[model samples]
Target: MDARLMDATFSRNQPSDARRLYDDRAIRYDNSWHPRFARHMVELARIHSGERVLDLACGTGLVTYPAANAVGPTGSVVAVDISTGMLAQAKAKQADHKHENVQLLQHSVTDLQSLLQLQGETFDVITCVSALVLLERPYEAVKQWATFLTRGGRMIVDVTHPESQISLITFERVGRKLGRPVPFYRVPFQSPDDARRLLEDGAGLRNVVVHSVSQMDIEGRDDLQAYLSDIQHPRIEQAFTIGDADRLFDKHITDWAAQSLANDDIKQKARAVFREEWVKLADASGQIREVDEVFVAIGWKQ
Candidate 1:
């Protein structure tokens, strides 16, 4: 689906343009550290054989495929995402891997309860990775998800720590440089406490547990250029259409350099260094080493 259709479909109630953004990012979504995060979320969810699983916003089936394998043929996984592009990629993966147990659906997470009711199905394990904060009504979505869980079933959600997200960092830095707020990158659940409260109070689930995990060591500087190229190209293209993104990015680096260096000449030199070796800048600033602080929240239905 193209951007025009996506916009037209969700135009009436477009508080969040996630569908369009994710549709644009669908092809390269897993190129970054997301696949590793998916594997970790699957492991943490402890999906067992013969258990039914629900993967909300199952972008490209990163978590869904792994969960399907863990559940084996006796089990099934219902993977749902709002973006058609993301679902298309996920369906292709399902076909390639012959994961008959996995089912891909194009639906918003906010409509999950209605979907579950229509099918009259419940899940032993429900997982939503890195997508909750994108929802228009995340608390309501969690409440709906809780209703679809079987007794004693677990619901696991992994929210990315804003500071650990390179995309958010870049957006914030650039937005500051432009002297404007980037509301798109601002998410509601900023900390583990926020997640816990939403699960326990908003969803009314029991025994809510929250923890953090990091995936910094997965891909080092060797894969940096390709990774950045894959992830940033689409975003930059989407964000800046009138001007050259490289030039804007260089200005962002120059502004960033000016903060640390007192000497004007040295700051200019620093900007040059940053522009030439910007991929390595993540490593230098400890961003790559602290790539993810994934806040995981698991709750159970009584």
Candidate 2:
């Protein structure tokens, strides 16, 4: 990787789970339900012809390509993400599709002013999807990015409700028991009102509209292997119950335990509590589901 990408990766000060997802899981991202949400975020942005767009944490150009199409040759879309691997995928897709209007930047979303001020540029719209909660200072990040929006320009972002990803929730619960708290991201965007507060209070945005998609998206059960595959690959929504516990533990949780720097006691206790929690999450038919309610909020600069 180049120095810029290296800085983008190592300098952001994000949570370790962000690093795990961007570095190791970027290639497998589109396999999850993220693309669906990304499309929804852009569709709601309502970009116009000849408008400039900034897409933050744009993994593999999910939002970029569609926004590029909306902007056409007369406009440009700058898609930024911290992961070189994710940008590489996006670059390949840009090449194959011949999208000349899109620029993929391997940069941290946390620092955009210096990144764009060099060009004296501002955007008509800014988008970030499925990424805000990963930041160490998510609201501050929003306020910083909002400064790059032109007068009356819109900022669009999405955050899942606290109940969305049960796997991470359960993992963090186990972490608390072991005295090492996994980075908990469930405190914000629990409702449409929460999303609006982040925009209005943090960014001083106006006319904020919070759209609650996936409100009705209840958890559904799958086999153990399939559920593991979803979380192992970083599902858009996570942690369902059911299936073979041994395979789930060996394949996914074992690595998690190691990464958590588990002593034998921690490992054994973690496994026990994880299994207990996992079993508790399952239904009578041995299936688990996630209530992945997501809020896509759009607000305009005053």
Provide TM-scores for the models. Answer: 0.68, 0.74
Candidate 1 lDDT, 164-264, residue by residue in tens: 54434444444334333232333566677887888898778889887666645433532322222121112221222222334644454323212222134
Model 2, 1-302: lDDT tens digits are 32123323333346434554576667887887667656666778998789999999888999999899888889989888888778878888987765588888877787776684325778999999878877768789999888889999999987765556555666656665666534445554456788899999998899998765652222573222222222112234444546544455555543422235144535677777767767877778887666646667899997
Best by lDDT: 2
Local distance difference test, each candidate: 0.65, 0.70
TM-score of 1: 0.68
Show the colliding residue pairs in model 2: 219-289, 219-290, 220-289
Off by over 4 Å in 1: 1-16, 116-118, 166-187, 219-291
